[model samples]
Target: MNEIVTTRLKPVSANLSRHKGVRRHAAIFIAPALAVYLLIVIAPSIGTLWISFTKWKGIGDEAKFVGIDNYKQLWNNDTFRGSFGRTLTLLIAGGFVVFLFAFIFTMLIREMRSKKLIRAIVFFPNVVPPVALAIAWGVLLAPRNGLLNEFLELVGLTSQTRTWLGPDLLFRSIIAGLVWIYTGFFVTILMAGVDRIPAYYYEAAELEGASARQKFTRVTLPLTWDVLSVAAVLWVILAIKTFEFIYAFGGSGTDPSASSWTLPVHVYVVALGNRSPILALGQGSAIAVVMVALVGALIFLTRRVMRRAVVEF
Candidate 1:
């Protein structure tokens, strides 16, 4: 009896020792990455949080502890309010339009013989520098002698030609440009998800007399819910941080109008724009903190809303 007990104990002890050795090796491999993350991401975030509570210009100025006054000022600033509202518009309305067009394009090109070429054309804008795209858009929408206005005149619809970059229309134009830029990227993602779905599922549905719309609703959408959720989260982050496109869209050598500013642009305007003599680094930090918080909250809400049972194939 004693010899049998010792034989079983030996294997158990060896297995436990091997498991510990594997964990030790894993920890060794993870240490460098963990250290870098703490140094780069965690450290800066904490510093920014600290700076948000103080009033400070850029280097050479002493930081004054203000106890949330920066946030209070931000709350009262009309320009900040407008920028925040525009940011939300870009996040919500822009996301809706982008996904809408992405779905449409994906459905259209999914079965096309020339789908690769079409996809490459659509995704070309994403590879181009956003600043360059914005400049091109600005030229196209210029109040006079612009290509769009010229085309309108040629088509005998001169009345439809107005200053596309005017204050009344600049934000709308930016939103439209954003939709055009991002739709292709989302289409690529959704197309990948759609492609993974077995063709037999659609065949099965068709045999049951399912129409095109019905197949899409009952088959495609359900299988791709996880991908769509991730894409939505990615859009939220991208939309909030958008800056260069809007900044350059206003034309060179001058700041964009306050009406077109998003939160990221607002941070630049507050902390470093030529319009201000002294930088409001503290206020900018406050804005950054708010943006981080907003991103976190929205991501949490999105995950909650999109949570569903895994539909395994």
Candidate 2:
């Protein structure tokens, strides 16, 4: 009985030692990545939070503590309020439009014979530099000799031609351009989710005399809910940080007009004093803090709203 007990204990001890060795190796591999994240992401986030409570010119001058004053001033600033409102609009309305078109394109492409080529074409714009795209849009929408206005005149719809890049329509044009640029990206993601679905599910739905819309509503949507939720969160982050395209679209060499400014652009203008008389690095930091909070709250709410029981195959 003693010999048998010793034999069993030997194997158990060996297995435990092996498991510990595996964990140690894993930690060794993860340490470098963890250190990099701490250095770049975590450290800067803490610095930004600290800076939000102080006044500084971001160069030469020392920072002076001013408790909540930056936040209070930002709250009362009309420019900041407008930028915040525009940011929200882009996150919500732009997300809706992007997802709507993505779903439509995904449905169409799923049944097409040349889907791979079509997807490449659709995704091409996304890979192009945003600055170039914005410049192209500006050229197409220029008031006098723009391509769009020229097309309108060629079609004998000259009356429909207007100054698309002017103050009256600039914001709308920017929104439309963003939708066009991002729709393909979401389509690629949604299509990936859709492709993972088993064909037999659709076949089974068809045997029950289901229509195309019924199959999509009952089968496709449920299985892809997880992917859609993640994509929505990604859109929120991207929309909030969008600056280059809008900046290039509206500005020649100076800051864009206030009507088209979003939160990121507002942060830049405040912190860098681009065409502005004064730089307010602390106020810009406050805006950054607000943006971080907004992202966290929206992500939490999105997860809550989109949560559902996983649909097993």
Predictions in order: lDDT: 0.89, 0.90
Tens-digit lDDT track of model 1 for 104-135: 99989988999989888888888999888998
Summing lDDT over every window of 10 consecutive residues in candidate 2, give the lowest-scoring window: 272-281
Clashing pairs in 1: none
Residue range 1-313, candidate 2, lDDT tens digits: 9999987778764676678577788789899999999999999999999999999987798999999999999989999999999899899998899999999999999989998898888888899988899988988899988999999999999999998987778888999999999998999999999999988999999999999999999999999999999998999889999888988787865888888899988888788845763578889899999999999999999999999997887
TM-score for every candidate vs. truth? 0.91, 0.91
Per-prediction RMSD in angstroms? 4.6, 4.4
Q: After TM-score superposition, what is the CA distance of residue 99 in candidate 2 from its true location, in Å?
A: 0.5
Least accurate 10 contiguous residues by lDDT in model 1: 250-259
Please identify model 1 stretches exceeding 4 Å from their true place: 1-20, 251-253, 274-277
